[model samples]
Target: MTSQGHVNNVIYNRLAESGRVNWTRNLAQFSDPKYQQEWFDLMSPKSIGLILASIRTDFKFPMTFPDRVTVLHKLVTKPDYSSDRFYLEAVMYSEQQRRPAAKCFEDIVVYDYRAAKKAPLKPFMVDELQATYDLQEQRKEEAEKKVAELQTFVQQVEDSAGAA
Candidate 1:
């Protein structure tokens, strides 16, 4: 049973390695602070909505709020990111955008929690994080190998137990 956190970590690493986290290409336009804020605001609603929609059930959203907050905090604090101010504003804008649907989307706390933890972002820091991810992937492979070996040993033990 893979936990959701593990799955998300894997997805994030894959995206980073593949250069899918290409913040530079889109964010290059944000050389100006004003433009950066606009871009952040635009991306915020879509990002939040997409994240919310990704929840498997309505209940999971509340349960994951803490983790969401942590990620947002990282986003805001990480010096690698370029447009922290805009990201914060964008998250605020997204919260406002959903005001009309407050009744249906009662879990606005999740968004608020996330926004409050907003860390400055490192647009296109994928290359910077690549080594870190490579180490993680290496560790994952080693763990898998160990698990496979353990499984083989367990099966052998079980087979001997049955034979005896």
Candidate 2:
């Protein structure tokens, strides 16, 4: 079984290799300076325990090295009702093809490593994650709208050409 930490590490490495420093940098900025040594300290080994309850991955297309890809990670479930459990969805988009190459849906549980049991997520952290998800949804909607508009324009052009 792949651990959540392992998956996170893989994504981090891929983003770094793709020269997407901004995405990683934005995530790192989530840590509060007063409590954390660094931005990643929020998920640091000493602070939090994350278990990968389940994961489903689907590949829409073959991915190759050196292909610029953008991975968008979003919180798929609200943690307010069940603070110990949540879902995150990651979509890897191929820039060259302008489409999604792969996607992963992960169910994660917050754990108490010291107690060896499940733990409730902090309210603040949950709020931040929800906000991030909202932003992602907004962006996705805008992109879809743009694509629809472009498709309509192309169809109009094709009809005019056919008539001529």
Candidate 3:
């Protein structure tokens, strides 16, 4: 937060970073043990890891402290992506405001730690991304309905807090 009570822009960057890491970790939940180990190796030594080639954030609404944020991530490509790199799109939802606060796009590469260079996407990794993406697509419709419900709930809570 700044002196003027606006959230510092830097905070949004960190939010995106945190969201992406969680997104990677959540991949384990949707896939088999082999896929789980792949994600684990991504963060470990002498293995493959994600390298951000570029990132862009579009701010939609203002958010303040004591607010709840839910950042959702999904691959930009469908299950058949066969590139050395891919993009992920994210929506940073401000629960307090009951709307999307920001949208983020990340261009990521698979980098080999030992080789110190970009690597081709492994089969397991591609499957993992696809699995998570497919599940997210299904949940997106359900979430849209819930988001409408949450708007009223969130507004009520905010109104109640202010009345205190």
Candidate 4:
């Protein structure tokens, strides 16, 4: 929060991080036992871990206090699943405002904690990512329908406010 009573820009990164962390945990938790163990081991502090290589946030609007915020993340397709690094895109949605407040893009790398160097992403990890991407693709149609509805509603509100 800032003196202006809105969330400071840096906080948006934390919101996106929360979404990415929870998504990874859920992905591991819901996967097959073998894959789950592999993912957990990869994320374990003693073993290889995922690290953020870069992040960029585009602010759409400022969110005021007392707003319920929801963060949603989807896998980004680039560099192929065999690559050591991958990307994710997240949107911060403000329920009170009924619109997105910011968009975040993250570049994540596989790293060997003990070796202190980059590591290749395992096959199981790539499979999980591919599955995740497929799921996102499946959901795109529903998301588009909802987005259209929201856009119509937003326009109505804007026109009414202007008339007032």
Candidate 5:
């Protein structure tokens, strides 16, 4: 990674394309809609054209879930109310055309608030408590056996000593 945490891929001969720069930076930056728009602006048509060429050169994807989510984040600028309906309609149309990211997009993307919540405790505590109780019961049984052995030895000593 460079000083900006961009992954350095100098050997790959992409002619120093900008999409690679955007991609190498953490995709988590697109969690903010404003940041998503900023990245879209940075992705001029020339850069996008170059990126498509580079991707052809690089053999990139059928991308993984996170990759697809990041690509979607890059593609969607926050639409103004007037444009939003058209944008949504285009997205719906593209989905019908078998755009690959549609299904996994929701799966890959998580809201910060949802991710930040505490994880639920599982039900294993009851089983652990039962195991501890069983161990204590076994110890008590061993203790009782020890006490009985001591009692029998004392009785034998008293009997033998009295007989003597």
Candidate 6:
């Protein structure tokens, strides 16, 4: 769901649009051929049910259309084995202001459409998600290492200049 604004309704719509786009893009990565076919198979099933259990949104800034914005989404929790639920957090950043315009948290459930009930998330699904999270963490560490190396190089150059 979206929070409403007094000026225009576009912001609410934009939030929903951005959230869907982010979810779709992130989930689509698992469909690549290199990933296990199980992930793709689970996602391709027509009977697989997805439901939004809840959405909490906080609007920190007012946004209007015609302005550029960036939306970021991250999985906040792994799927609960017992409950078959997962959580996702999302943020909308205002490009012009360089600050977050809104933040949202969503609770989602996996349902078995054929049985008409909630179902446990398959083990393969959980594994694939964990792998994705690990990849992201690895990239973050690599970037931090590069930054630290650059900082060390700069410090050495400064110290040599002082000794000269």
RMSD for each of the candidates: 16.1, 6.7, 8.0, 6.0, 25.8, 5.1
- Index of the highest-TM-score prediction: 4
Off by over 4 Å in 1: 1-124
Q: Model 3 lDDT vs. the true structure?
A: 0.82
Q: In model 5, where do residues sit more than 4 Å from their true spots?
A: 1-122
Q: Residue 72 in candidate 6 has what lDDT? A: 76
Checking candidate 5 for backbone clashes, the offending pairs are none
- Give per-model TM-scores: 0.30, 0.65, 0.76, 0.79, 0.27, 0.65
Judged by whole-model lDDT over C-alpha atoms, candidate 1 comes out at 0.33
Q: State which candidate, 4 or 5, has the greater TM-score.
A: 4
lDDT values of the candidates?
A: 0.33, 0.64, 0.82, 0.85, 0.32, 0.67
Instruction: Rank all candidate structures by their lDDT, best first, as comma-separated numbers.
Output: 4, 3, 6, 2, 1, 5
The sequence of per-residue lDDT tens digits that candidate 5 reaches over residues 1-164 is: 34553333332222223333444243325334444443443244322111221122232222221121222212222222222110100111122224432211111111123344322211232232234345556776999999999999999999999999
For model 4, the stretches where C-alpha displacement exceeds 4 angstroms are 41-44, 78-81, 141-164
* Number of clashes recorded per candidate: 9, 0, 0, 0, 0, 0
Clashes of 6: 0
Please, what are the lDDT tens digits per residue for candidate 4 over residues 64-149?
A: 87788999888888345558888899999999889999999999989888889888787777777888788788799889999999
Candidate 2: the clashing residue pairs are: none
Can you write out model 3's per-residue Cα lDDT over 96-129, one digit (the tens) per residue? Answer: 8999999989998788888888888888778777
lDDT string for model 1 (1-164, tens) is 14542333333322232221234324435354544543444334532211222211111222211222111101212133333332110111113223211011111111223454434333433333333345556776999999999999999999999999
lDDT of 6 by residue, 1-164 (tens): 12442325445545754575556446656555554443334443446545678878788877754566777777776554464777777788878778988887878777777788888776656766666667767887999999999999999999999999
Between prediction 3 and prediction 5, the one with superior lDDT is 3
Model 2 Cα lDDT, one tens digit per residue, 21-89: 343246547745553343344344565655668767676766555457777766776568358877877
